[model samples]
Target chain A: MSDQKEERGLRELYDQDPERADYLAFGRKTETDRRGFLKGAGLTAMMLAVGGAIPFARNMPSGLIPSALADTPEDFTLFGKTGIIIRNDRPVNLETPAPLLDPDVTPIENFFVRNNGGVPEATADPEAWTLTIDGEVDNPLQLTLAQLQSDFETVTLRMQLECGGNGRAGFNPSPRGNQWAIGAVGNGEWTGCRLRDVLQQAGLKSSAVYTGHYGADPHLSGEPGRPSISRGVPIDKALEPHTLLVWGMNGEPLPLIHGGPLRVVAAGWPGSCSQKWLTRIWVRDQEHDGPGMTGLSYRMPRNPVPPGAEVPHEDMVVMGPMPVKSVITFPDTLTDVRADEAFEVRGHAWAGEHEVQAMHVSYDFGATWVEAELEPPTNRYDWQRWRARITLPAAGYYEIWARATDDTGVMQPAVVPGWNPRGYGNNSQHRIALNAA
Target chain B: MRGRKLRTGLACACLGLMMAGGASGQTSDFGGLPAGPGQLETFGNCTACHSTMIITQQNFSRRTWDEVLTWMVEDQGMWEMPSETRQIVLDYLVTHFGPES
Candidate 1:
């Protein structure tokens, strides 16, 4: 049928002049319809017979395009594919508790997958990447992603990256990290260009004072060839103007499974310094031997190792920032009671860079304490979301606890000071047991 | 004649980019296996960066894939094959995924 009347006359000439569409023109064109210009010359001769004169279909190379449809928001449910779906769909328990997601965002699809080696190769050329800041710098730059978007000044915050063994399955006998469950920790916004405006546009010479980074992903597969993960910061958290080097997220771009064009969002530390798919930065001046820094791998033994203890080989250290915690999340654990009904005690409280400031519920296991209803100030280490309301008066088997307190008084430590060999900070408190109507 | 219709539209756009690179190297699933006698002559070099689900999601044991192939050939540069092709890719990954034995 004359190519279906030349595709209904080129969709009625792009529904009648869609801004003179020549497929949104790149230039030179003047066909004037010889039957929809021979249907745009038979769809440009069927796209040059299926592309550049088919040298075997021009090497069919445009594949691997799923990072949730690259660049976000197809009704943003955090890049679906079931890798991160959460809106109260709970199931996170890497080893104890840590599932917060909105007290000020944690959704990179509920962040927290911490792999020492896995999930890399989301490429299709993020503009053929390249960052490379270079060790102990004076000038060694390299950039390119259109020279970091026509040279610097981009900013955009929202922090909280997490991962220092994010609750290593509550460690008691199980150590060795990556049991991760508090959904590791996310919150993005990001939009790049900062790490102190590219380390003060590469000048820093007061003996640098640490910054390190590095990430091109690779490694795993019989492992070892260096580049997988690297960490560092503390040149005053790399000059903190909201320490970045991102490359957009949440608002788009950045999504090589979350770490596209670049990464290193830091915020308040532990998520092993937020270094994903990045690519070198260096700067050090001392102390940062990388390899998860002076080995003992993400340490943490200041003291607390008895439940099956086997750590020896010298007390450990590193794994820092992350303590005041809390969690209960809706009367879950025993539900179905009404002898005296009176529920409502939602959960979520965090600490890391400080400012959770309160959250002290207990009910009957910690024995005494009550004061929940927090959810203010969302950023500066993120995570505060809370909600309370309890009053049973009769029913039996109950427990319910939660405990938080930051802004530097640093509370929430009912027990945890031991489980090293790689099971970093596992703040202890959350307890749920519901049942009353 | 418009330069022979622009040299027949650039020879039909170079035969449509060599027939889309021969229909994407004929649907690459590591494009047809064959080279297996072993000593790991790079059985498609770590599947060009992984997937054998990183050696069948390892449970480990051929002394942990020979201490992870001797730490990726002495600290991450990997590619020093021939110790009889790394004992035939550590004997076909501990004989078809070790550890369960």
Candidate 2:
């Protein structure tokens, strides 16, 4: 509460005194904020170094440079995570490169990290971690990892997890936040109990209509009470057998970077629905209105708003299942395929809340199309691998395109589907450049 | 106590920041915005919450820039700037980081 008051005061400084407002915003006390910050030790040193060009002389965070200016550091791929495109470093938001995501089951090292806030400190012992279930329940229960394991029936399923803004980079005029390509996704076999089973143990009251999630991540602003991002599903979606409280990923203890100690994995939904480092589940009688749930945060315009329209809160709806999408993974964008006589191409296709009924590949930019043989998903909600063979007509500067059609008849668009304020639900067909000699 | 304030001003912003020490260039930390009118005010106001990368990377028109500013206050928790300050910052952004620039 005091932090909220302090922040409001800091914001008011801009109107209070425009001249010294910026300096005063950071000062601990309002009384001494203006002149004291102007004559501080760091400013004194900075003034000396810049030879009294005092107005623009305050350096960033004492020798902090923009990550773009710095070369890619060797140490970014920590905890065996590798070959990822790091869009921002402060909160550690990184995405996998398309090539590295080719594996049948995405390896942990190649998985993307989409952190909205600070990565919570790695638990010294994960087993000691506990989870709290409250709100609209007959009995609120606090359970440790051991109890969660022994108390509930566990199930393992291979599921596809994709960010809501997976292909945001393709949006023209650009959308805000992480400019992810088609790599902010992964499929892994997660081991956990159904959220339904656990919530029943808490004895949900009939009024439990929605759920709000909370996690260990603190806000990027370093505010202790603030949550980085919290979102949840409706009562019906929450009750799905696939909605799991996952503790393990791909046969290993969930790595800390991947939200190890505990997380909620609601497959086929936007990755945000699967809260990482989950600590609390607040079952609500109404829809959850937490950070990521309200307004345009992870929502699509209910009625398509023009590119730059100032959409009202009511026009936006919380993101639901991901759209049908496919990506070419194999034959790895080989620069030179010797005058191809039917070279094989393969990739993964997934339909959110549906199945990929068909996948088509084009070597000549949609002028011609050929069907790829789609394999059955190892389990429902898992990605299906598809393969096809194509022969280029007198190869020279060709590209490979892949698109998927969902069971419900939605086809991947060759171009971006619709422009929302945040550049979400971009299920554009993915293509890779290749030179055929 | 005042020293701590300056550090807080420099050390953190609204969006997350990394303390990559030994950075030699002050302007680089300010996202390498070239010196111009409103440069100081813009840096002071914006660097508090976000790295200039957010600004430097955009390719919006002057109109879009204005809309983004309005949206920042309405949706993204940015305080409404004083009228003069807002005009100055807008002018600086368009001049230095507009689509044509």
Candidate 3:
């Protein structure tokens, strides 16, 4: 459309005030909101008339907001989300800024979102959701949301959900996916019923060796029957108490963007394993071969590969629990602190399926290290917050690096770890830079 | 204090709302991609789904770009182009969009 002018205006407003500009630009949902804004503002008709049509025309829903027309970052904002960097607007992959991830239990607002498909329209009324438990189960139960709540005993646990590609951006030679940094990880106090209880009630058959998960999100290719992504966990993992059919996040109904109503909360694993808008759990006799489960989606190379070597699908191994990782929260990377000032350097550290036993801070690269006070996690999967007092005598520019060692004594690599095709699991030490002028 | 620039990421140049009050027009117009033979085809095909920001953000080897395209077609359901057109796009991508370049 001739909305180069509108984009210019919106970008100007955004530069001045991001939230306000966001509210003005987005802040509207529902077909009513879409029709009301577009018809009244006449931008929709203007866009149609001028551009003929948008690209990926087959994929856009009726009232889809054109993100390409957006001013900066993205032209899209969901209900109650801010400060997230939009990786891809089509499937709604969002990454939170590392500085904003300071809280121990990530609030719904601050939590990152990684969607393989558009949010299902069924999220509008989550109460009507139905979950089917079939395939290798003695008792296949079709449970509704109300039935699930009434039947299962609910429990809450603080745990971490990280994307397998959380550190893909750090990979050399550059991978071809969302270039997420450390922001793809978050720890949240999730409240839901144990998956074990449900499977136990359903009575899993001896044939069940794994579980295949299915969600209601639509395919990105606009095919009605094509699944967006179907992934799952091993049988033992699916039976963990921490692996939950989550409905509440930080004491609120899981926000739709974060996979609300009903979804999996398999902590310490790839967030994809915790399928959002969960609808089905297929107990399988073998390893699940779903869309995201195939080839190199979440698999890492078996042997260490050089930076740009091609890896065969058969040689890769499916990633298990994430490795030990940490990030500095306070004194953001862009921060400017006064010289010779003593301040508390604080952050959070976690190991997938492991407890972080020690945390260290390096002021002058890895040449020397000082121990930070690390707190014991409330649960096995919860990230432990660590803090230390440090003074910079004089600063031109300084980087503070954080390293965490798991109970098993595995330390985060100082640089990007070995590379894989899809760039999974690079738990390099997190470093933040600050300047003193 | 550094006077109002929190997000100084050189790669994330096109944030729609949380902007740095800067020129993002470059991101749409090929992100300053040099003029080449297959530039038009690359723009139409690549930007069909994502922004040029996604493209320019990458600093890859020619082989990696090929793998990326192979994934796009095989896994991500990208429409298959003619072999000739594919080679042109590949050559253009490898030439202008390499680590050294």
Task: Score residue A54 of candidate 1 by CA lDDT.
Answer: 25
Once superposed on the true structure, which residue ranges of model 1 sit more than 4 Å away at CA? A1-78, A81-109, A112-123, A126-128, A132-137, A143-203, A206-235, A239-257, A269-349, A354-359, A362-403, A410-435, B1-101
lDDT, candidate 3, A1-437, per-residue tens: 11121112234334433332333444422243222233322334323322333222222222322334342353333444566665545456667778788898988877888887766763556777999999999999999888888899989899989998998888877776777878898889998899999999999999999999998888766668677889999999999878999999999988777877899999888888999888999999999999998888888888988987788899988788888999898978868888888888999999998999999998888888989999999987999999998887786888899999999999999999988888888899999887865
- Interface residue Cα RMSD of candidate 3 after superposition: 14.9
Q: Which residue runs does candidate 2 get wrong by more than 4 Å? A: A1-79, B1-28, B31-43, B61-83, B94-98
Tell me the tens digit of each residue's lDDT in model 1 across A94-206. Answer: 12223345335545544544545544656666765888786777897888666776688886766656667665656655443234434456555677877888878888888
How displaced is residue B32 in candidate 2, in Å?
Answer: 4.8
DockQ of 1: 0.03
Worst 10 residues of 2 chain B by lDDT: B14-23
Sorted by lDDT (best first), the order is 3, 2, 1
1 versus 3: better DockQ goes to: 3
Which candidate achieves the best TM-score against the true structure?
A: 3
lDDT of 2 at A87: 54
The TM-score, computed over Cα atoms with residue i paired to residue i, of candidate 3 is: 0.81
TM-score, per-candidate, Cα-based? 0.28, 0.78, 0.81
